[model samples]
Target: MHYVKSKSILSAKNGMNLYRGCTHGCIYCDSRSKIYNMNHEFEDVEVKENALELLKKELIKRPKAMIGTGAMTDPYIPAEKHLKFVRNSLELIYRYGFGFTCITKSDLVLRDLDLLEKINEKSKVVVQMTLTTADDELCSILEPNVCPTSRRFEVLKMLDEAGIATVVWLCPILPYINDTEENINSILDYCIEANVHGVLCFGMGLTLRDGNREYFYEKLDEHFPGLKARYIKEFGNDYSIPSHDEKRLMEIFKYRTSKAGILNDTNEIMSYLSEFPQKSVQSKLF
Candidate 1:
């Protein structure tokens, strides 16, 4: 890991990535795509040394809104166990009376449950987790460096019991690998049991671009020999490789989420994540 001074923190939308690159080793990571243009290795992990200071300053100046992270890199990556950047950022968000949300694949997020709960009470906090495959073995193969789906389910349950809202990103389902009725159903069952507020699924297939495409094909060759050749034959260099089963899989997704009363519309979920709580507004007014 290396630290670099950051000129600023929050995005125009109040999102910030305190770290760059990742060590999660997820084979389908889009962050590795060349379009992002990272000068360092994907595993090197560039730390924004002044992120917390900048965040505190920005929080004081900007009108209250939800502060988000973990978009480009998982904030709870293994490095977080020692660095505590995410945890410190959470403290600032809570202290400054801003809502918070993040997308992560690590159970390490549970370490900051106390602060998350506090933020929830004061404003709002939504914990969004990505669950692509329900099978633990496949999860290991797809997201090797992160916690398994079973453990993530437990984390979701814990968050539910703590009165924190949760959301799941069930996506990037690799075709001919995990794109199956059984796999989708199993993950949906977990979302139902966890009482997640929503499930965001763009489609049943994953996107492969320049940098990530080569890396994904290499991993496919290593683990599922001959798969890369099949991908090239089938997909060529297309960006969006929709699953042959996309229509059927999306039907299932809509059916399950609708029946469970969870928000399935992408626009609706994004709105929920950005909306600050009415209670927070009233408290501030008084």
Candidate 2:
């Protein structure tokens, strides 16, 4: 890991990525796409040395809104155990009375439950997690470096018990791999059991682009041998590689999430993530 001074931490939309690059070795990572233009190896995480400082400055100057992280890199990556940037950023967010939201697959998020609860008590805190495959063994193969879906389910339950809201990103279901109706229903069951507020699923397939496509194909050859050739034959450099069962699987996804009363629409989930709690506004008024 290397540290670099960052000029600003929050994006125009109030999103923050305290670290760049990732060690999570997920084969379908879109961040690896050349369109992002990272200068270093994906695993050589780039730490924004001044992220917390910049966050404090930005929070002070900007109007209160939900401050999000983990879009570009999971803020709770293993590096967080020592660096503690994500934890410190939460402290700052709580101190300044801003709502907080983050997308992560790590169970390490439970470590900061105190801060999340505090923030939710004052404003809002939404914990969004990604669950692609329900089977532990398959989960290990797909998201090798992170906690399995089972543990993430526990994290969601924990967040619910703490009175913090939660969302799930049920996505990037590899076409011939984890795109089965059983996998989708299993993950939705976990969401239902955990009482997640929403499940964000764009579709039942993954996207492949230049940099990520090469990496994904390499891993496919290593793990699922001969699958790479099939992908080439079938997809042939297409960006959106929808599953053969995408239509049927999406029906199951929508039906399950709708029955559970979980927000399944992407727009609704994004709006929920961005909305600041009215309680925070009232507190400011008083």
Which candidate's lDDT is highest? 1
In model 1, pairs of residues that clash are none
lDDT of 1 by residue, 1-286 (tens): 8999999999999998999999999999999999999999999999998998999999999998999998999999999999888999999999999999999999999999999999999999999999999999988998999999999999999999999999999988999999999999999999999999999999999999999999999899988999889899999999999899999999999999999999999999999999987762344554
lDDT of 2 at 71: 90
lDDT of 2 by residue, 120-147 (tens): 9888999999999999998888889999
Each model's backbone clash number = 0, 0
Query: Candidate 2 — which residues are off by over 4 angstroms?
Result: 280-286
After superposition, candidate 1 runs with Cα above 4 Å error:
280-286
> Model 2, residue 195: displacement in angstroms?
0.4
What overall lDDT goes with each candidate model? Answer: 0.95, 0.92
lDDT of 1 at 95: 94
lDDT at position 252, candidate 2: 92
